[model samples]
Target: MKQLRANREKGMTLVELLAALVLVSLVVILINSVFLFTEKNADSLSKETDVQQNLLLGMKVLTKDVRSTDGEQVTVEKNRLLLGSDEYAAKNGQLLKNGQPVAGDIQSFEVCRPPKGAVYREDELACKPLIAGEADENRIIVILEGTANRAGKSRRLSAMINMER
Candidate 1:
């Protein structure tokens, strides 16, 4: 009887062993899932950061160009800004400037999509002009709007650019 009892207590019963194994497996799976979730969140954050940075840089370039515009003839022809001088034709895709294009930085500019029937605020799929007025002559206000995405969320940024005379 003593030998039999000792043998029985020497190892875990089959059912107990199975239950412990299942518990351990579950814990491992849970930990793995948590790690995966964290990794996904980090990836999303990285993408968001990239988009925000690009949007800001693009906006800065555009605003600088708009504000530095001189002798601007702004025509609100359905959300289109027809600015520049007679010498500079305000075409749909012209990069107008009084002087030559800036070496590395933009001097003056405008952004507009093709003129549709009504200037819908959301028809941004057309060839808009990124206009830049005279090199250092014009000074005006430029309004900009765009969407910046971050971590699966979208943010709208609107800014006004004022150029010095």
Candidate 2:
């Protein structure tokens, strides 16, 4: 009886093996779920970041264009700007430069000549009409707003661009 008991104790029983397998499967399932959740979040965040960077780049290009053009060659309207022969606008959810897409996922683009000597404050562009005696300013206020489709995120950029020429 002692010899038989020693042989049986040399290995796990069928029930114990099955239980171990079940435990391992449960652990694998839990880890897989966590990995999938993390992947989804990472994708969403990446999309949001892409949208933000695109907006920033678009703003930089617009600023460069405005600064390079002469003040007399600049035209500001409610939703469009013309810097000499170059035209910038937001249309059909895109930021367009001379009818070509500059950036995608844009919601709105607004251009205005703020009152003379007006300054930008927190959320206050103050794009009001100029007073009769006020001199025309050599700058423009541009606002760009956009949304990321899959990420459900939005961003806005406001700039005061000065025409140097």
* Cα lDDT, all candidates: 0.44, 0.81
Best by lDDT: 2
lDDT of candidate 2 over 44-151, digit per residue (tens): 888777777778878888998888777898888888998899999988888899999988768888888777766677377645666555745587888888785574
Off by over 4 Å in 2: 7-14, 126-136, 149-152
lDDT of 1 by residue, 1-165 (tens): 899988878888889999999999999999999999999889877766654554455456545645555635434332334445422222322222343321212222333323223232333333344445422223223323223334334533334333335
Residue 2 C-alpha lDDT in model 2: 94
lDDT of 2 at 22: 100
For candidate 1, the TM-score is 0.53
Give the TM-score (vs. native) of candidate 2.
0.81
TM-score of every prediction relative to native: 0.53, 0.81
